[model samples]
Target: MRLKSALSKVFASFVVKGIEKWKFDAVAAQERTLKKLVNEASHTVFGVDHRFVEIKNYEDFKARVPVRDYEDLKPYIERVVAGEADILWKDKPEYLAKTSGTTSGVKYIPISKQSMPEHIKAARNALLTYIHETGNASFVDGKLIFLQGSPVLAKKNGINVGRLSGIVAHLVPAYLQKNRMPSYQTNCIEDWEQKVDAIVEETINEDMRLISGIPPWVQMYFDKLTEKSGGKQIKDIFKNFQLFVYGGVNFEPYRAKIEASIGKKIAAIETYPASEGFIAYQDSQTEKGLLLLADAGMFYEFIPSEEYYNEKPTRLSLAEVELDKNYALILNTNAGLWGYSIGDTIKFISLNPYKIVVTGRIKHFISAFGEHVIGEEVEHALLSVANEEGIEITEFTVAPQVNPTFGELPYHEWFVEFVKAPVDLSAFALKVDKALQLKNIYYFDLIEGNILRSLKITILQKDAFVNYMKSEGKLGGQNKVPRLSNDRKLAEGLERYIA
Candidate 1:
């Protein structure tokens, strides 16, 4: 334990130094990284098309390469999938990270040898930063369980393909693998239920010091652990458990429930990692935002949320962003994704050291009646109502109910799964409606003008989301229910599960 503590201190110090160096002069660091990326990919097809050689500065680069979404780059990505070389990056990608799509059936994101190291480095730094901030280095001495997807990868066009989490699992450092839980054999089980069971059976008695995963799924793991250990809380089952690392989804809704399940307070670390690149991580224990990884192998652009849907949105670089404004994120990465829009929206909360909070998604919103309600508004409203009403909700989704066949005017329909159901369902719905109106001016106007009917709420049966994701073959890792949609696709699909 003494030796482990000493090593952890050394690791923490090293990470602090690295972070300091990267953040020394944020603008300068980003400029250097951008220059390096442009120079490295200058020989690629994309670079040639965009006239990379003539680009002398950020303005030149922006003027040449227009921002693009996954659909916009589909043609180029298709060529890469067909084993084409030097199309987007200098060389073909080493692997493709597959993510679920809303419009497209699936998205294949390239992961090059150069970018893989960036992902690994960012993850390591996130943990080490946590240790440095909290002085909790003892976690390294014990097991750390990460609820990841199956590591079994598939081949596509002779390139490896799989979920990002699964890919990262295969790349775990050799030394840390000794302290990682849920043996490789267990992680390979594709079925989430069986995998969780195997994990519980294997690690119930182990010296678990840390756990990491999406909050909802991690909550599921905690539930299973408690059940298997005869109703003891997770903290009782794993006495040394110290940290809970989460990413991929908003952790606010699940925070209270998870804390209750654990029966003790544990430090939580939040990260913002997309298949495109590792973006940010919670760097300070007291601060409420994630510090942007400015020098990672990616260049970033932000289009103000208000202008995001415009034909030609104004793109701002890191040095141009303002504090507390939502912006759609765009990226140029070493992994062959250039000027790519990842669809997520974020707001800068601090600028000196550069920190942000992910607000919502560009494609995930309800504007059918010009209410223009985004995921951020819905999440805020839900959390506000949940707190005010003393209710605990596990999962939820909102969609428009617009068909006249139902003999009612159009309204927003909500499907909610509650861990602690509200005593007065009608009052709960009313409270949520009022909260939404408060959050969105257009929504309020629509309701006041009687253009849209009152919102409708439907309680979902237990594990409704889990079952829905299971039916879609996306049961566990990184999959989440979209909070708001302009149409009824998701809501209608989940109708059968409504209680």
Candidate 2:
């Protein structure tokens, strides 16, 4: 083996051993993490304001700090952006991750020097865990590509401000710099389509081994490569490709299409990373959940997702979580985020080691007529039916159509772009509708009571989602269409692309 490859194996082994230290005692790890975070930030502006110094335990911490979203936390973040030090953390943030928000417009999330490494470490551990499990470290010898935003950052009061992926671009370890692609100049291109073209141009003939990105963007790259190569599949162009690492959206809905594009199956790792913190990662290839990062520099809290909008919801510590219950994740981190809701929903699948699966987004749900429908339900409904029927879809989204044509009852509208159309579209729609009913009791009750009609599927033209995202200026880099929406905005916008 080459020197770098040998070193990678050694490092992967070391990391896995470190993981074992706290993997079994996750509850204690989280307690230690919370205590450390609170004690370290006790003298900071937010800490002082929230009485962090007086917090002795989780109950005390919760009593002092209320869970807040980006809008609620904007004032403190604004102060940080204006050159205020120790407002949210112990000192000035090392960088600000800029992201678009629905209600708040643009949002800035701080990343402290102490907390940034946790993000890098969790990602590294995910890969190293794979190596330790399968003894496959040969990919380190080949080229790797991560589809992400530009690394070029703008300044916000002396703080480097950019997308989280872009900021992460500057932190690729020295040992892997030579193996990473597309060139910094190519990645810096703001136009996503042009950047993909440049990436394809640069990577087409290389010994590419690992591809990482949000699945949709990677699919776009594969499409370009296939088109440019006169219909040759991705595997033909890059035979050494062995792993697909993705996050930001559930992969099951896109699995068939992605595998078809690649012309074969490959191992994949899913990570749960957010602007607030790196939360969880797939620790075992055979396991269904991501291991929650209990020992990371962040403390966690959970609110039952159903009660999230209640005046006062039940908040649970790691020790209090139950299996298979969906909760809105909250964070208190070394980065100075205290009781911050990141807007994502997750369900604990394992308690002993604290493993979780991303269920959906707190805001991305369709409760238009009292029948709440979440992302997990919609995805399970669609993918279960599609997989059963062997139908392949390129992309899809769901929205409530409260006002239908003439006297028709309100119904869920599915906008789907299919690679393989079903033999009977109406039958396919009914199957998905029934599948969803089985998953959500409220939806089932609504349908049975005639409060809502069966879901409807609207066939979309090729690249309809791509066009919609481009029109909205969210073409790539961690941007994904919400799987469920409560209103008709997305449905109305998608009307133009009806096939």
Candidate 3:
């Protein structure tokens, strides 16, 4: 009864918050958020430190800090390693989030103790939204399956130095553990079979209902779960499951497989939360509400889409930030970062632009022969073809390759682990080609003359990607496969299978 009452309260709060959010359109939210941001930035910059306190409107603090990438912070991390405060204001930051990013070697972004609640609150809001959507707050009653990173700590001299995931794991309410599932340590999932076996043993017989994790790892877990359940498919094994919540990357490619595995069309929500900040989420029916932690101690910046078209690109401040623009995102999180580019690009879908679709990564692109191709264009074209032909892409990647006969071809090769293969490759290829042409005229022109060849498709075993990620040691957590390769060597490694 206590659990039921608590869940009810959570649901009520979510419904209220969600409705309140809808009342204030995306642009209005930005209007409010930006004003707060400028005010906060003034104090934060002038103080030369980050902390949770309202700043008096100091004019000098309003100067915009230059945008920076992960590379810019290497020296600060070096300072932390040498036992100093580094970029953050606090003399002692509680811990740092160690998540892998593309083109950037392992990044150790400082995470603050003050910022921790903001993350937890966002996570809870996500859960509440899920419960409100599916009417399944009973998950708190059943085993709350979290396909998450483990809480394993490195013990130095008999004291625990928290792993990034561990700090978050420690925040899980003690009141909620009686119905929780096992957390397979991300560090330990290296022994895939054993970890899979343990999770299956713990969760299979129990009435496991809800799950949250990255799509790749969640897919792997379900794949393994299906394998051990007397050859029963995933859908059959977890038939009673009410929710399959996944985040950490784009879920569009793997959506069908997850639906097929679960047997029923469960509540499928796309979450855009990270260790850095809780930015957005998608729940039942309403256009993916990017529930912003407006009051969180973070000042956000947006770089207009037009900037990307320029040779020497610059970014847009919150003042200049407008609606319906694609921008490279920068965050001045409660975690010490001044106009830090987190590398993700998003298009504000509305004028009251709280809703943003993470279009692609800024650096995930290929350029050669005056043609620039990025993940958004590829995904748009692929999905356009999928919608036209009533087909779904399982997984895909693109690369620019040179041909002796032709100048260059941006090859869009993909492996589709479909339930049923397309009956007409020729027709599907033409559809995909047309979509590509529409998105980028340069790519289309190349295809017409074989400068860029026609689209290529490869059908692999359904679990091929799951197994491949496991084999490559990138199956779980924050890791996502790069959709575009910068050159031929890496592209060639993946090209032979293109049909």
TM-score for each candidate, following the candidate numbering: 0.97, 0.99, 0.84
Q: Each candidate: what lDDT?
A: 0.88, 0.92, 0.63
State residue 449's C-alpha deviation in candidate 1, in Å: 1.3
Lowest-sum lDDT 10-residue window in model 2: 1-10
Candidate 1 residues lying further than 4 Å off, grouped into runs, are 404-407
lDDT of 3 by residue, 1-499 (tens): 4566366667657555765654355444444554555444344322344332433322222343455677876666556544564344354456666666656766666666667787776666666766666555666666777766656655422223454555677777665677677753533454555665678777887777778777767877787788777667665776557766777667777776677677767766667776667777764456654544445666566766547546556655444555656788878765666567777888766434356678787777766654566678878877776766667656666655455335544465555555566898777767876787788777767667676667666566655555556666776556677777666654555444433
- Give the candidate number with the greatest TM-score: 2
Query: Sorted on TM-score, highest at the top, how do the candidates line up?
Result: 2, 1, 3
lDDT of 2 by residue, 451-479 (tens): 99999999999999999999999999989
Which predicted model would earn the best lDDT? 2
- What is the number of residue pairs that collide in model 3? 7
Stretches of candidate 3 exceeding 4 Å from the true structure: 1-7, 14-64, 132-135, 155-164, 183-189, 233-235, 309-314, 317-320, 387-392, 404-411, 415-420, 445-451, 458-464, 495-499
- How many clashes show up per model? 0, 0, 7
Clashes of 2: 0
Between prediction 1 and prediction 3, the one with superior lDDT is 1
